[model samples]
Target: MEITVHSSKSVKPDYGDSSNGDAAFASADVVPLSVFDKVNYDEYIFYVYAFHPPSPPTTVLVPALAKTLAEYREWAGRFGVDGSGNPAIVLSDAGARFIEATAATEFAGSVKLLTTGDKVLSLYPICDGAEELLLVQATRFRCGSLVLGFTMHHKVADGPGMWNFMVAWGQVTRGVAIDPVPVHDRTSLFARQRQDSPAQVKFEHRGAEFKPRAGGEIPGVSCGNVAVHADGEEVVVHRVHFTREWITELKSRASSNRGGAWSCTTLQCVAAHLWRSVTEARGLGAREATRIRVAVNGRARMKNPPVPEGYTGSVVLWAWPATTARELLRRPLRYAVELISREVARTDDAYFWSFVDFASSGAVERERLVPTADAAEVPPCTNVDVDCLLAIPFAKLDFGCGPPFFFRPGYSPAPVAGAIYVLKSFEGDGGVDAYVPLFSRTMDAFKKSCYSLTPPMADARL
Candidate 1:
């Protein structure tokens, strides 16, 4: 299909200032581009696919196309990054193509279905030299459908920031003005120096070298299978909320066993539930070893003074703990929670620096990192599996559109077996929404378990 081109914008040239007695592109001014730059800025991408009803009329798709164009124009005005220090907005040919193609493909890909996954591979330098801050791509299928793809650098924005941009795009497409443009706040969550003494390491891990026993592909269910075939029905997202009381109880339970180590109750409980659910779905007994990793932010954990909150820089960290299924099930949930909590804490200490040192020391071959069968094996897991917590408040992210139906997390290459969970706080309800991606079969097992378990016990609170 011939995709039409729309309007484009670019950041003002003067935005980046080499003047004022400062060096060009101070480390502070430029957003860190690498995941290794910091711990808090975990790299991730979000994608949303809007599938039209089967055999939809062309007339209906035209209005959708116009709306999409308008939305891109407004977004170009709001967040374009200039080459210089000052933040200026600019739209590029690449950006325009990405937006127009996505709209056009909706009618071309014969989508019948859509999906997204975490892009775990390292990012290479942009060779195109486009002013666009995001890499948007779309693929059309033989069956009149489309898959819209967006690759955003974490330093430029977080999940909340990206959602804000989406909201603006949606509103502009609908021909509405966004009220009270969102403010970028960089003062609050400044990156702290490593010297700041703390009681214990926030997060810790066991078996950093543990590799998975199985190497090749294993026959399992796909997302499409679970969404369409498992029970032979359409799959719709269900937003859920947990009472504050439940959060408190979970925190209390986790803290009780750790001798009061600082741990995020939300992270601990969610991990435990997912681990157990997957084991049961695979019909693997609790005794089988499994490995899970949580991505952590390294902003405050750095030895350097904390970076200002609005500082667009890369701040990401990853921590993994591997254990046999038998041990995970045998231990109290609190134990697992403590393990996660401790691992998070340690990132601020010398251990975190050691990791950085090792990674920078030399060019490590990918094959060496790949696990062998005889190697002390741990169940496989990837960053794509864990739900990344976008620390920014959702309410703070306003891009013109009032809000979104839901903010889903997506990736490029699918993970081994689990799904990526994207968390967003609803605008009016003050509730948390998690976009979970799982194998079609696993989702089926999850639903069945939810239905069979007693109501109160089945609650995520437990």
Candidate 2:
């Protein structure tokens, strides 16, 4: 797809009805970076949306949308990226970004054919500068479907925070009051006055063992049965669609065999199913060690001064569940679901509150803490990793023109056969779109073995 940039400029915060005289929103020009925000440092979390608006012939979409977004706290916050690329956000004076670009493609086709590494992603100024906390890009497709998206430094806000801002932007476009107004007081997790000791703040994330393990061979689970071989160009991106009906059917099949008061969430079911299927496709043996890494959002659960309803910051923790390839493949899907559900349940107020002190004390220099009720279960070996951004309301974001039908995270950090990104379905049904990158052979096997792609089976009685 060909694209051309029109204009790019910094947008200052507009303290209009949204501010409500709140000091964090109205007066505080410099918002201090919190522990979670700083941990991400200079990195960014990107979002892309495909919007089919009513006024297709109008030419003022970008400017109007840009104006609507820059008025809120989440957008106006500025990042202070020192030479090291670690970002800091200012509260009020910091401006967001306004970018206008034109894509030489139809909107629907653009959404269907989009990929993380495609050239169409060049429209955004992701690598342009470090000072801006929020960057906005509006691409007018030839078919008049506008693709609106933003890139926020991970330090400024997490996934939920980012979506909150986007939804609020939508509210503004509809001439409605912003509900659950953004509370930029990041002190809900950390104190504003406490100073970070110069030597205490560290950036390196490594293991805590006396001797960190070397070599790619993970020993917790045997690897003889592994079939994963996606590397370099051999790896390809493919999406597996799971309808609500099929998911419910799959979950029932797995849950029926297990006896417990607890059940699996949709996300747990999908991720576990993918893990097991991918492992099977890669031909990993039943005994080979396998692992899944999940990033959990810690907001409503935190106690003491709970993170406010509209607080925007990177409030997340990574939880890992390790199992043998046999356990993942042979066991029912609920087994993996149980592991994930339990892992997520372990993250509570104490865990996050402890993290505040843990981050400030420079404990990461010694070891990375994996919060779990059963720490004994954590494998002492390398784990196959899958990054998940599920359940966040991406498809629900409606900017007065109805909700977006497609949402793509823009980029992938993992190599081929190395990642799993689950989001809402393309049809906006009660389903999921699992964006996976696997090697050619593995993906082929996955297509054959995984029933997630098939249509829902009709009931026998029906």
Candidate with maximal TM-score: 2
lDDT of each: 0.40, 0.61
How well is each residue in 30-67 modelled by candidate 2, as lDDT tens digits?
55667676554245556777777563322344444445
Which 10 successive residues of model 1 have the least lDDT summed? 118-127
What is the per-residue lDDT of model 1 for residues 1-462, given as tens digits with 9 covering 90 to 100? 334434222212122221212222212222222223222332334454333223223333234323432332322223434465433333322233233332343332321222222211111112134444554443333344433445554435554445555554444434455332443323223322345543232222223422223455533332321333233432223223434455566567655655765556576665655555455544445445566667665555665444334333334555666666555555566666666667666556365555444433332233233212111121243222465564554343222223322233444223233544635453334334444444454566654542221121222212
Give candidate 2's error at residue 25 in angstroms: 4.8
Report how far off residue 328 is in candidate 1 (Å).
2.1
Instruction: Give candidate 2 misplaced runs (Cα > 4 Å).
Output: 16-20, 55-78, 81-87, 91-94, 115-125, 128-131, 191-235, 259-262, 285-287, 365-390, 394-396, 412-417, 452-462
In model 1, state the lDDT of residue 462: 20
Total clashing pairs for each candidate = 62, 17
Candidate 2 has its poorest 10 consecutive residues by lDDT at 218-227
Taking all chains together, the TM-score of candidate 1 against the true structure is: 0.53
Reference-based TM-score of each model: 0.53, 0.77
